[model samples]
Target: MSTYEIALDSKAREVEWNNAKCDKYDYMISVFCGLSAGIIDAFFVGTPGKGRLGQWTDKTADNMVQKIANMLWTGDKRSSVDGRPKNAPDTLEKAISYLEQSFPVNYDARYGKDLINGNAISGMSPLNHHLLSLAHSPDIIGLLFSIIDQFTGKATFINNGKLIRLVPVKDARNNKVMYMQGTNFESKVFCGVCNWLGHLISDLCGSSSTRKVGKTGRGAGLPIPFYNLFLLMDLGKFDSNSFADIAVKIFEEGYDLRHGAAMAIPVLIEELSIKVIWALKQHCYAKKEWKDCIPSAKHADLRMMLLIGNATLCLVDGIDAAIRTGIKGGNPITFILHLNLVAWARLVMLVFRELKIRYGSIVDQAVGKYLAQIGLNDAYSLKQYYERMNAIDQKLDSVLRDFTFKVEDDYKVFIQSLNYTLNSSLRTPEQGRDVSVAIAKKEGVKSDRIFRSQEELRYWLGEKK
Candidate 1:
């Protein structure tokens, strides 16, 4: 295994397990190895009794924030500055410099038979992913969110401020097709992830990086509230069934990654939920802001984390639709994996809460019966839930084993697409500089996918011009 995978394995091992420890390991490994392709595969294969909700499917939107953040660490050109490469984002100017270099400016000259050599950007569709799988294509590449691009010199910026990743693709083709590798192209998941991460101190290596480079806040042309800290509430402390619902509500109110690393919810609350809730109470959360600040208004990053986490809850409202409608043919596999992982995580928390709320006699009665008689009074519901959890957990382990690039091909495809788009060529040889971006935009999106519109593609690539 590579050093990166090993380190991730160790970290995964260290994390405590509630449902299935092994499966959790697989999840983490997949995150580092290939972005969870196995989960997607399994969902499409249709395990057992996987029910549907109604009309919607996984075609809506994919929250690839974690993957984007991870790419930042990989140093895509989107994270580089003019004078400062991603491999080194020391001073505030360096960070700012990197952002300016990536965000695409002139949309007019993009469309043509070939890319402008260096001007190609990727789209955010599965087609780019498909091409990334191609073996002998020079059009493949990878990208990074602004976080990791601290060392690479290419990352994107919003106007003159707000540094983040435009998209971390590895190739010119990916740039042309994938809409910068962003799912919510118009919504700004790129900047949101960057601004969200900015609220904390990630690479504390030294004086150069974002560790402390800026005028307290607002480095480069970055926004004033780009990294401001704000705390909302701790859901774990609440004693009501509405807590989760309330949490979801807060997420809808726009607490997205703009506010904190995570809300100081109880450890149990974090464990029960389906999504990964990064705790900010210890290492970085309490240390910096909450150390001596007031309870409600202390430590800005934590507040922002919570804000984002909370808002994310609301964003996931379409789960019911996805489950009900069933996944589309083009995206069936991926949607299944995403839905399962997300749903399982959410349900786990809800179940745990139910256990706590209906405690005492119910617990004693059920377990006592199970210990005494196999099927007497039958606390069958409890037994069933446990049994199902075990099965799912086991399945998670199996699915996770091959979810990444080394185990699967989709990951490599995505990586390759990324590489194809980020080349420093100001123009293309085979396809003429004008045609380069036209081809790139197409590379990111596949005509087969459900969401992308050809008109929008034309507008972005200047085909409309």
Candidate 2:
């Protein structure tokens, strides 16, 4: 066995049969992996569920903000999700049907094709798609809601030099918009926009990202309120204008990366690691031949060790790159400290991955029984969601499965028709894995799978097992 495989076996040998301990490891890994994907999903490519809400699903924050800023410069009203068409934002069909007569003069030519082709961006990575699968899953919506609820809070803000606490005020449409006490911005500013009756507003014109939290008011040393990103969502459409709405809110809130590297690095690394692990996990489960290959507990442990070990190595390399970049910029010592934290965290995850591989089934059974006995269920909901989504993706794959590029010169018409935006960038196996790992670190996306090299083709064909 390889050195890493031996280490994994050793770690697996240290597993204990404690339900609580196993649950802790399970939660840790899932949260670290899932939340990383969730945040990226929430930010970059708002899932269909969040997109239906007109949230930040258009593009990356930087992309959206820059595009909108350019549009604003050129007086482009046709810059919204659906452009200047008379379509409601509630539905995708209407959004597309109402595309404006023309895009902005300076708009990227690709944007027009992307918008019309319904492929504004490249397909999401496997990890991102996995999180999105959960996002769109009816079963896990409540779980996601609960996770968001943990970070939900009423934000305290300063409006027109007056410190005020926000409270929700329902408009005639029954949409809840937060209001500030002793303020006339609702009647004065917001009323002019919609002319609704008895509408109120907060003092700061609207929800401020630079707001305070529960008893401890905003101050010089207080940590930035990351939760406001969620709270602002509750503030309704008035709070959302562009994808950058959340990004700007996060920036304006407090404790930027430069200011709070100590606290920030871990949060960044944790999220980064989550994306890495999630992308790796998808490949592990994607092996159809390996589905029943995990027969014995030992076999399962070895498989998991391979999965976790690869992911950990990828994450270590990513962080190591960041560390090197930081060092060259004269921040070597500070980066060393950050690297130490990541190293420790990496060790914990490896140990947990091994133990979970051994005792995970036992923990699952215990948790299942406990959940059933208490009426709190859906222990396998995430798995079910992934399977359903993967099935759909597989059906789409079937349509193209027979079209091998080795004889591509014969079918011209078929190729032209298949030029849709969704799968424009097909991958060879070697390129695919490298792209998967690289993009997962750089963009938090997993792109599509590619199998070109001999070993990879064998793996993809299920001949390697």
Candidate 1 residue-wise lDDT, 259-371, digit = tens: 11111121123232312222232325435233223222132332333333333332342353255446453233223323323333444554465455447578877676675
Candidate 1 wrongly placed segments (more than 4 Å): 1-96, 99-381, 400-465
Q: Which residue pairs in candidate 2 have backbone atoms (N, alpha carbon, C) closer than 3 angstroms, thus clashing?
A: 125-446, 125-447, 159-203, 159-204, 429-450, 429-451, 429-452
lDDT of each: 0.32, 0.34
Question: Clash number for every model?
Answer: 117, 7
Off by more than 4 A, model 2: 1-291, 294-298, 311-315, 322-326, 330-353, 356-465
Per-residue lDDT of model 2, residues 1-465, tens digit only: 999998886565434211112234434574455345333323332211122211222222223333433443355455456455343323222221221123111111111122222132223221121111111111234234222221222122322222232221222123333222222322323322221111111110111221222322121111122322332343333333332233233333322222232333334555456445534443474342333332333443333433443354346534653655565673332232223232344456666866686688998888667766775455545457557779999987876654533324333433433432124377554455554455444444443454335577688788976
lDDT of 2 at 337: 25
Per-model RMSD to reference: 22.9, 26.9
